[model samples]
Each structure stands twice: as C-alpha cells, then as structure tokens.
Target: MNRHGQRIGEPASRWRMQIVPIATVMIASALPLMLPLVASSPVLPPLGLLFFLSWQLLRTEMWPVWIGLPLGLWDDLFSGAPIGTAIALWTAASIAIAYLSQRIYWRGFLHDWAIGALLVAAVQALAVFITFPHAPAGHMLGLVLPQIIISVLLMPLFLRLTGKFDNFRLKRR
Candidate 1:
C-alpha cells in the first residue's frame, strides 16, 4: 500500500481509459454546430446519433442506459433542437440496443450496421417531423432524406472509428 492506501503498483484511477470514447461521441454530437450556417437544405449526417450508436454496438457494456441523458442533452443544446428530444430518443435507443444485444447471440458488423441504419432512418425522420411540423411531408422528406442517407452510409466509418478509439484508449502508456 502507498501513502494514499492504494496498492503501490495500482493506478490511482483509470479515468483516461474512458476519455477517448466519450470525447469522440461528444465531439461528433456537436459537429453540426461547429460549421458556418449557409446551406438552405440539411446536408450534414446525423453524426451524433451515428457515433453514439457506433459506440453502443461496438461495446455494449461500456455505458449504462442513462448515459444517453447527458449526452443527448448536450447534442440537443448544440444541434439547436428542442431540449428533451434527444434525451428521450437517445435514452430509448440505449435501452433498446442493450436489450437487443443481450437477446441476440449471433452478431457481426453487418448486423450492427443494419441495426444502425434502422435507427438512423427512424430517428432522422422523426427529427424532421419535430423540426418542421408545419411543412409538407414531401418538403421535409426532401430536406432530411439526403442527410439520412449520408448518416446511414457513414455508419461503417463511425463503427470502425469506435473500434480504433477503443484500442487507443486501452493502449499501454
């Protein structure tokens, strides 16, 4: 034992092991707001959601369901969406994925990507409805459809990045 009562060879804490994953997701969540606002139509993928799901699928045990509350709230604040929207959706998605991952024994990257596509399409479509309730369906779909496509297509990249982040976080100092 050392002066602080911890074992001499033991780490004081393993906080750094968690920093990379959480930071990546948080930064991805805030990406849209970091850009200059010039486009008449939505173009950026829902990177926040994609990255969040990527982490969840990559490591189901890394975070608890409630983790979504704070992360989603952060996304809402930065994405200019109403508060509570992301909180609810992200929390719900977390719970759902936890359940699904537990129930399924046969899993692979393509399976994860398909699940991500379903969630992304649904969530992105819902966001459009919430953001433009008064707009015609065709107009809203036109604006968000491309974004959904991009988000779905980008799922693999985010998933791979999550794996890299996991490896980086676990690397020996």
Candidate 2:
C-alpha cells in the first residue's frame, strides 16, 4: 500500500502523467489566437499537438481519444472553425492512431519524427478537405506544405522538450 493506504493497483501519483497533456491542450487552443499578431510563429495548423498526441497513441496503455475531445473543443473555441469540426477531425485521427498503435513499434526518435510529419500532413489535408473543399489547389498546397515541413523539422525538438516534463504513462511491452 502506498502512503495513502490505497491498493497498489491504483496509481500512487497521476500528477506526473497529467501535466504535459493538459498544457498541450491549453497551448494548442491559445496558439491560434496569437497567430494574427505573431508574424512567424512556429505553431500552425495546430498539428504539433496532433503529432504529440499521436506519439502518445502509440503507447499500449494510453488512448489518444481520451485527449481528443477537450483538445478539439479548445481548437474550436480558439480557431474560427465550426464548434465541433476540429473536435470531429481530432477524434477521428486519434481513433486512427489507436488502431495503428497496435501494429507499429515507432522505435526511434527519427521514426517518431517521420510519423509526426506524415500525420501532420494528413491532418492538414483532412481538415482542409472537410472545411474548404472549394479552396484553390495552390492555396491548400501553399499552406499545408510549409506547415508540414515546419512541423516535421520541429517535432523532434518539441518531443524532447515535452518528454523532459515526464508526463504520461506508456506501458512497456
């Protein structure tokens, strides 16, 4: 029994695993609000959080869907998008990650980075397709390509920073 005298099956401390996820949602919601003022902010398309959550999805013990709803609601509120649109998209992506999680190991830092990039691209494409199907091809490509590239480049570093926070529980196989 822990100091609380609770059964060992219960987590002795969840604060360790909760901080980053909560902060991620908050930042994801607020970043878009700052985009209009910041000429060259690194956070865009809100895919950095998506990539981060995707990384978590690969863990057997955790599910991305658990985080998706709140993050999506935050995105909807902060972004100009329809109330549930971002939520639906994020929830779907989380489900996809969960399904794929069982099949892939995502073994190395580079691998995680690559997966993050591709997933970010996919999220951008999906969001665009859902929101603005009639938008010009060049416009869509112009926006998505840069965001994807930046997300890919920065993902490793962001992961390293967040990883240092030591939040979230990933079961070891």
Candidate 3:
C-alpha cells in the first residue's frame, strides 16, 4: 500500500503511466504528416508542438529535459523539417517552459494561453525563418498568422485533453 493506504497494482501497470506523455506527444507530432490531401494546408497548426507544450505546462515533472531530443528527432523525421531544427527548437521550448514554471508560482488558464500563443508564434516564426530566410515579410505573415491564431485558440482544448490524459494516467487500476 502507498502512504495513503491505497494498494498499488503490479509494477508494469505502475510503469505504464510513465510513458503516457512521451508516447502521446510522439504520436501527436506525426499527426500533421498523415493528413489527407483535403486537409493539407500550410496553415494547419503544428499538433505535435501544441501537444508538447500542453503536456509540459500541465505536468512539468513528467517531462524531463532529455526527452526533448528524441521527441524532437521524431518530429524532425515525420514533419520533414530540416534535420536538427526541431531538435534545437524543441529543447529550447521545453527549457523555456521549465523556467517559466519555476518563475511563476501561480498560474491560470489565461496565463497558459498567453504563453502557449507566444511560444507557438515563436516556433512558427523560427521555422519559417530557417526554411525561407529570404521570403517576403508579407508572405511570411500570410502563411504564419493563421497557424498562430489557430494554435492560440486551440490551447484551451489541448489543455482539457491533456488533463483528461492525466486523469487516465493517475486513475487507480
């Protein structure tokens, strides 16, 4: 029994919850890549990053610094982003979130939403800058604005979903 007088399950079941974050984020990262032709648009928000940020903000302890590398590599492979781009960006974002969590003692949905928006916008801008360094400002804005707006708008939904996942992970077997 745990400290609260609850009986824990087998070792495997207890361990299963540990993989939930990485597994879910990795899977979410591939979602944009598998889209059917009809839904293919440059404006589609980066689901993987959205999920990653959501998970990080919701449960900072579950995501350690090192996991970013493999997850970023997975994103790089599937998203067709330049090699090492996601690696650097993902790691940086994770670190930023960790720092933010430490600096801010109290957090709310609005705060998370704002941070998520800024991070999503920054990632999108960096990716575009890296991929199309010479692209016109107007063109870049046109391509990225929709994605940023959508990502920001979806932050609440993602947070809700992550919370549900957390509930599942912590549920007694």
Query: Each model's TM-score, in the order given?
Result: 0.88, 0.72, 0.88
| Most lDDT-accurate candidate | 1
Give the per-residue lDDT of model 1 (tens digit) for 1-173. Answer: 65655664564336757777788878988877888877888888878888899999988898988988999998898887788888888888899899999898799989999999888888888877877789999988988898889889999998998888887776544
List the global CA lDDT of all models.
Answer: 0.85, 0.62, 0.82
| Per-residue alpha-carbon lDDT of candidate 3 for residues 1-173, written as tens digits (9 for 90 to 100) | 88865686633346558877777888898887677645334777788888898988898878687667888889889877788778888889889999999999799989988888888889878887777788897788688888889888998899899999878787666
Candidate scoring better on TM-score of 1 and 3: 1
The per-prediction CA RMSD against the true structure, in angstroms, equals 4.2, 5.1, 3.3
TM-score of 2: 0.72
Give the poorly placed runs of model 1, Cα more than 4 Å off: 1-13
Per-residue lDDT of 87-173 in model 2, one digit per residue for the tens? 777776677666666677555766666766666677666666666678897777676677667766777766666565444342111
Write down the worst ten-residue block by lDDT for model 2.
Answer: 164-173
RMSD of 1: 4.2
Error of 3 at 145 (Å): 1.1
Instruction: Report clashes for each candidate as comma-separated counts.
Output: 0, 1, 0
| All candidates in order of lDDT, best leading | 1, 3, 2
